[model samples]
Target: MSQQVQAVIAPGENEPVRVETIIVPDPGPGEAVVRIQACGVCHTDLHYKQGGISDAYPFLLGHEAAGVVESVGDGVTDVAPGDFVILNWRAVCGQCRACLRGRPWYCFDTHNARQRMTLASTGQELTPALGIGAFAEKTLVAAGQCTKVDPEVSPAVAGLLGCGVMAGIGAAINTGQVGRGDSVAVIGCGGVGDAAIVGSRLAGASKIVAVDIDDRKLETAKSMGATHTVNSKETDPVEAIRSLTGGFGADVVIDAVGRPQTYRQAFYARDLAGTVVLVGVPTPDMKLELPLLDVFGRGGSLKSAWYGDCLPSRDFPMLVDLHQQGRLDLGAFVTETIGLGDIEQAFGRMHGGDVLRSVVVF
Candidate 1:
């Protein structure tokens, strides 16, 4: 039987998304249908509407989401109906080379739903954003994509682990390897950057500096665990970071903005033999042309964090538990909550730096 779901669909480039009735199929083998409770309005969704991610028009736009499994198809085992889960884009194929080598985080093959969700009226195939479109009442995903977690926390908060939150925290804990007494610097105090700051604090970093052009976001960063804040608009961040780190620089500098300028600042703002982690999503036109000697002179790893190098099965539940225990501030990241129809306005708010995350609550 087909399920009728209210989905946010971007029919063409730069077009406003419409909430339309979409036909969701019964789950196929290894697939499960989740009744979405909440989905965050991330920048990626806006990018999809702008034709930045792909030319696949009539795209079902959403990814960061959490919900309860409504049904399961044949051969599904990891999740069953009634289980609460956070949807993950990277459903690791354990038999892949990266997984075989014991690094499932870099799984070469990830899984999505076998069938496509389409427009009910036109029967037009709608490409799902990041393979998990959860702006609807229900969406289909691979069984492996649903990572079960505690149901005590609101889905509005738990769903965040599906994306940006995971990216920020994982960037610090996984890519940066921030440790006790380490000095860490995060550029761009958006949701991801703030999450990095929180992660740094969680990892026991002694000094966490947050750099941003906006004073308000910097202040929020302070609340999230940034020991110091730099208004990058009025200051040279690289120099400010060095001053804060005793004229050396932070042991780790993260470019959460993912621009050439911010990346350059992060590149030059780290202490010798320190790491520079890029977790921000950059546009294709944006290019970095730093000196070759600088890359070698740094003497530390230059890494790009993909979804914060997170293993959904390992990180989501643990983080959810942390949130439940009040160890992590997942709730703090949610600046505002709205219905699915508010996504387009939420995109504007995101662009205007008005909110950290505008979650769509079903």
Candidate 2:
């Protein structure tokens, strides 16, 4: 039997999100229904509402989530009912070319529940944010999307590993490959950038400089293990970063803001042959122009991090265990907890830069 549950949804472009009852059907083969414990409000959710992601109206908007596996359908063997798990967007298919090459994290074919969630009032099928609509009390997803972890970890903290937190950490460790004693500079001191700082510290980077336009965020970045701070709004960040790195520049510079200006700053702010990682999302119409000579002269990698290029199965459990062992401060990223009804208010608070994340808790 189908069950009705309240969920946060954007009815149309630029519309405010509201709690509406939606129909969740029983899981089919390879699917699972989760009883959501917590879900984080992410910028991607805002993008979905603004139609930045697509013109898919009536979007079910939440992805950074953790929950208990309430039930599983036929062919689901990895997770059972009552298991604590973090929901991921990428459920890799082993047959894909990337998976065939042993890089399942880059699997071209990720999985989502084949069933459709419908709005009870109009029977309109809703598009789930990131294919994992998790704003509701219960959500259906592919069994492969659920990565079981320590049930002892707080759901709010564990939920973060579902998206932004994992992206930042992976941006450093998996993509940028920041090593021990390497100097790293992260542009943008938001939750993702701060996570990059945490990852850099964990990797034993001797100098981690955090760059942000907001002084408050810079201070918080310090708490997240930033060894140096740069107020990009007040000073030329490239010069500041270079000055901090003994005029040679950092080994790795990550642009968490994802703008032309920031990318250019990241371009010139690194030492010769130093890697530059672009982790921040860019608008579709956004374009970049760099001097060809400069690109050749830089002589290093310029890479974009898609969800930090993470493998949910390998990364989620290790990160949760690290947090449980008092090494990773996952709790610091959660600034406040709100109910599903408070999503609009939380969206308003997102730009304030003080709140790292406003999580929706059931």
Candidate 3:
């Protein structure tokens, strides 16, 4: 059996996402059907619409979602009907080399639901965004992709742990390995950047610096645990970060805005031997032209954080527990909650930097 539901779809490049009727199939083997309760509007969704991700037209959008499992297919044992879960895109295949080596987070063969949701008419098939489209009443995903979490928290809050929040927090704690009393700087004050600030604070960083072109986001960063803010428009950010860190740059500099310029700034904003983490999503055409000598002279690791180096099974529960304890302040990320129809407007707000995260609540 299949279910008919309304979902946001990117019909073509630069076209506004439309809410249309989408047909979601029953869970196939190793799959489960989830009745989505909430999903966050991440920048990745906008990328999908801009043809930045792919030309997979009529793409079923929304990935960072949380909901209750409605049904499970044959051989599905991880989650049963009635279980609440946060949908994860990376469902590790234990046989993959990364997983076999005990690093499931880097599993190269992460799986998704084998069946594709599609348009009812013309028998046109649609590509599910990030393999877990949830901007609808329901979404189908690989059973392993649904990580069961405590259901006590509102779905709106729980859903964020699926993406941006995880990226930001994990970039600092996991990838950057920020330690207590360390000085951390996050370039770009968007959702991912602000989450990095919060993560630094949670990791006990003594000084958290936020750099951005927008003053509003800088203010938002402060509220999220930044000890200082730098409006890059009016000052040299790398120098300011250096001065703020007492003649040495931050111990960890994160480029949350993935661009060559910001990447350059992040490279120059960290102290010698300090780590520089790139958590930003960059364009395919964007190229780095740094001197090979400088790259070698940096004396530190230039790393790109894939999904914040998050391990769904390990990080999700621990972060949820932190949120439950009221110490992590995950609520700060929710600027507004809107219905599925407000997604287009939310994307505008996201580009305008007016909201941290506009979540769609089903």
Candidate 4:
């Protein structure tokens, strides 16, 4: 039987998301129905509402979520009913070229529930954001999309592993390969940037410099483990980072803002043979122009992180364990807890730089 649940939906471009009744169908083969316990409000959800992602209208906009499996369809054995899981967008297909090459994180094909949830009133099909529409009481997703984790953790904190937090931590640990005693600089101190700082610290980075235009964000970054903070509005970030790192540059520089200018800052603010990891999502029209000589002179890796190049099966459980052991402060990322109806308002607060994460808790 189809279940009727109140969900958050972006009806059109730049439209305010409304709480509407949507029909979630019974899970089919390889799928499961999840009773959402908590979902984090992320910038990506705002991008979806603003038509930045795609023209797919009436989008079901929440993705970073943790929930309990209420039911499973035929052939779904990875997860069973009553299991606590963190929803991940990337459900790797083991047969893909990337997976065959032993890098499933770059899986060419990811899976989502084949079924669609419809608007109960109009019967219009709702596009699940990132293949895991989660701002509802319950959602349907591929069984692989649900990674079972320790149920003792708070849902609000666990759900963040689904996206932004995972992206940031992965950018530093997996992509940048931050190591002990290395100097690291992270540009843009939002949730992602801050998480990178935390990851770098966990990796034993000796000098962690955070650069951001907002002093407020920089202050937050300091609490997250940054040893130094640079206000880009007052100084050149590349120069400041270089100055902080003995007139050289950081061993690893992460560009979390995903802007061309920030990309250049990261490119130039790295030591010789240092790594520059671009974890930020850039738009199509955005372009980068750097001197060919400078590119050669940098002599290091230039990489982009997709979902932090994280393998959900491996990373989520370990991170949760770290959080449980009090070694990683995942709960620090949760700035506020909100109801489902307040998601639209949370977006505005996010844009205004008021909170790190405003999670929707059911």
- TM per prediction: 0.99, 0.99, 0.98, 0.99
| Range of the 10 consecutive residues with the lowest summed lDDT in candidate 1 | 293-302
- Which lDDT tens digits does candidate 1 get at residues 1-362? 98998999999999999999999999999999999999999989989999888898989999999999999999988888999999999999999999999999999998899899999999999999999988899998889999999888899999998999999999999988999999999999999999999999999999999999999999999999998999988999999999999999999999998999999999999999999999998998887898899898778888999999999989998998888888998999999999988888999999999999999998
Tell me each candidate's RMSD, in Å, in order: 0.8, 0.8, 0.9, 0.6
Clashes of 1: 0
Tell me how far the alpha carbon of residue 243 in candidate 3 is from the true structure, in angstroms, after superposition. Answer: 0.5
Residue 27, model 2: lDDT of 92
Identify the runs in model 4 with alpha carbons over 4 angstroms from their true place.
none
> Mind giving the per-residue lDDT tens digits that candidate 2 earns over 183-212?
999999898999999999999999999999
Measured with C-alpha atoms, the lDDT of residue 65 in candidate 4 is 99
Better of 1 and 4 by lDDT: 4
TM-score, cand. 3: 0.98
lDDT (tens digit, per residue) of candidate 3 on 110-192 = 99999998887656899888999989899889999999889998899889999999999999999999999999999999999
lDDT of 4 by residue, 196-293 (tens): 99999989999999999999999999999999999999999999999999999999999999999999999999999999999889988899999999
Best by lDDT: 4
